[model samples]
Target: MRIAITGSTGLIGTALVRSLTADGHHVVRLVRRPPRTPDEVEWDPRRQWVDTDGLAGCEGVVHLAGAGVGDHRWTAAYKKTIRDSRVLGTAALAEALASLDTPPRVLVSGSAIGIYGDTGDRETDESTPPGHGFLADVCQEWEEAAGPAAEAGVRTVFARTGLVVARGGGAWAKLFPLFRLGLGGRLGSGSQYWSFIALHDHVAALRHLLDTGTLSGPVNLTAPRPVTNREVTAVMGRVLHRPTLCTAPAPALRLALGEMAGDVLASQRVLPRRLLDSGFSFAFPDVESAVRAALTDTR
Candidate 1:
């Protein structure tokens, strides 16, 4: 299959490109800048400009282009950037794909479990109602922007991802060094549920979705068992052979992250019910095992 991808330099996109290429699929990267190679297609989501002719033969599209929610302080401008990046990028991709002579069979657009907001301890699946907040609003708009592709009879899948656990460059990566030095601790009251998934499983589940025609809409790319923030700290300490004795209070988080503190402390007890029901098995289904594998150099 020929696959066109946006955000190919991102954590998930990088892994997806490697895996998809290894599986013998042709991959084209959609770039915001001028195309430097035959494999790159120029696109400007903000301007709604895409090289539709270059994407003529794409069999599938994985739209992962978006501003990183945790990458910057949540200033008013940064918040708008977050929303615009997803909404505009997705809208552009969907519109472009809709214009293709042979439109892609599937559009696995990126989303987040943040759409569910603070779900407390409730196990949320695809059918669950979206909760309130900026993140939720952003996700809602992001998914809605893909309406063009879906309305054109294209099979669209919104990968409502969770906190992806990986060795480098993700949330867990930043936490690993601190935890390994025995400086890790629980956040806030340490009771908020943290829904997460291993990077390997995340990529694999995406591949599964690409192959499965029945799966579409919002699919939670999370583990079956969700853990509390305290549990996460304890498990990381156990894995790293360290002790979690300190506490990072809500005030400190608010001071450091500003309005993004809500994101850091939000409780989203999501479940991969759709994926599981579709018979997609996970490589790391629990926090303990997932952390060990992700943090360790060897499997």
Candidate 2:
């Protein structure tokens, strides 16, 4: 299979590329820069320009391009960047795929569990209604932009990802150093459910989606068991052999993160019901075991 991917430099995309290539599939990158090699295709999502002809031969497309939600302060401009990056990129890619002579059979576009907003402690699956807020709106629009391919009879799967736990990137990476230094703590009341999945499982789930033709629409790419912030802190402390006594006050987080503080303080208890029902077994379903494997995995 020939796979084309956007945001190939991102943590998830990087892992997916390696996984697909190791499985003996040809991988092409939809890059923002000019194409310098046969495996790279140039496109500017902001300008709504893509080389449809170049991507015509692709068997599948994994759209992972987007501005990092936690990478910057949520200023008005940065918020727009976050929204535009996903919507425009998705729209452009879908349009290109729709115009292809041999359009890809599958489009595994990126999404987030944030689409469900603060679900409290409710276990949300693919069938649950979307919640409110900025992140939700962005996710809704992002998935909607892929309508073109879906309408054209292409199998479009939205990877509604959760907080990916890895040693070098994502939420876990940011927390590791703090926990290692004995400065780790829980956020807010430490009761908000934090839905997370190990990066290895995340990549594996994506691969499963690519291979499974019956899976489509929004698939919750999360773990079976979700933990609270306090539980997460305790596990990190245990893994690092540190005390979980430190705590970040809500006031300080609000002062520093401003409106984005809710993202850290809020809870989203999600479940991968669809994936599990479809017989996709997880490599790491528990927080402690997932953390240990991710921290120790060499590849």
Candidate 3:
């Protein structure tokens, strides 16, 4: 199968490309810069432009391009960057795909469980109505931006992902080092739930979305069992054979992260009901196994 992927250099995208190519599938990378290789295509999401010529003949498209939400302090400008990056990019890609004479069979658009806002201990699935807050508003707009693709009869699946467990990137990248030095512990009250999925499972779930013709709309890419921050800290310590003694106070985190701290401390107990109902299974469903998998899956 021929597939086109945006943000192919990102942690999730990179791993997905590798997994697809390992099975002899052709992969086209949509890059921001000039096309440097035969498999490269140029796109500028801010301008709502993409080289559709390079996306031709693609059977599947995975749109994951976006500014990192946690990469910078959430100043007014940075928050705009985060929102615009996802909304505008998704709009551009969806429009481009919709315009194709022969559109791809499916589009696995990236989304987040942040759509549920601070769910506290309440469990959420795909059927739950979107919640309130900044990330929720951004995520809702982000998914809605893909309307063109769905309207054009292209199957659009929003992969509402959770906190991916991996040593390579995301929040885990910073946490792994601290935990290795025996400085890892719970955040805020340590009671907040974290819906996490192993990197291996995350990539596999993306592929599942691409292949599953019967599935559509928002599908949470999270483990069935969500764990709390305290449980996660314990798992990390157990997996790395280190002591978990540090505790980051909510006030300290807020002072450091500004508006972004609310997201960090928010509790989201998300579940992969759609994925599981469609016959997708997680390789690491529990906190301990997920942490262990993150330790081994460097990519």
lDDT top scorer: 3
Writing each residue's lDDT as its tens digit, candidate 1 over 1-299 gives: 99999999988899889999998999999999999999999999999889998898888899999998889999999999999999998999999999887789999999999998999888888899999999999999999999999988789999999999987666778898889899999999999999999988999998998899999898999999999999999899988999899899999999999999988998889999999999999989999989877866332
Residue-level lDDT of model 3, residues 40-131, one tens digit each, is 99999999999999999999999998999889999899989999999999999999999999999999999999999999999899999999
lDDT of 2 by residue, 110-188 (tens): 9999999999988788889999999999999999999999988789999999999997677678898888889998898
Estimated TM-score for each candidate: 0.98, 0.98, 0.98
**Model 3 clash tally, residue pairs:** 0
**Which regions of candidate 2 deviate over 4 angstroms?**
none
Better of 1 and 2 by TM-score: 2
Question: C-alpha displacement of 79 in model 2, angstroms?
Answer: 0.3
The CA root-mean-square deviation of candidate 2, after full C-alpha superposition on the true structure, stands at 0.8
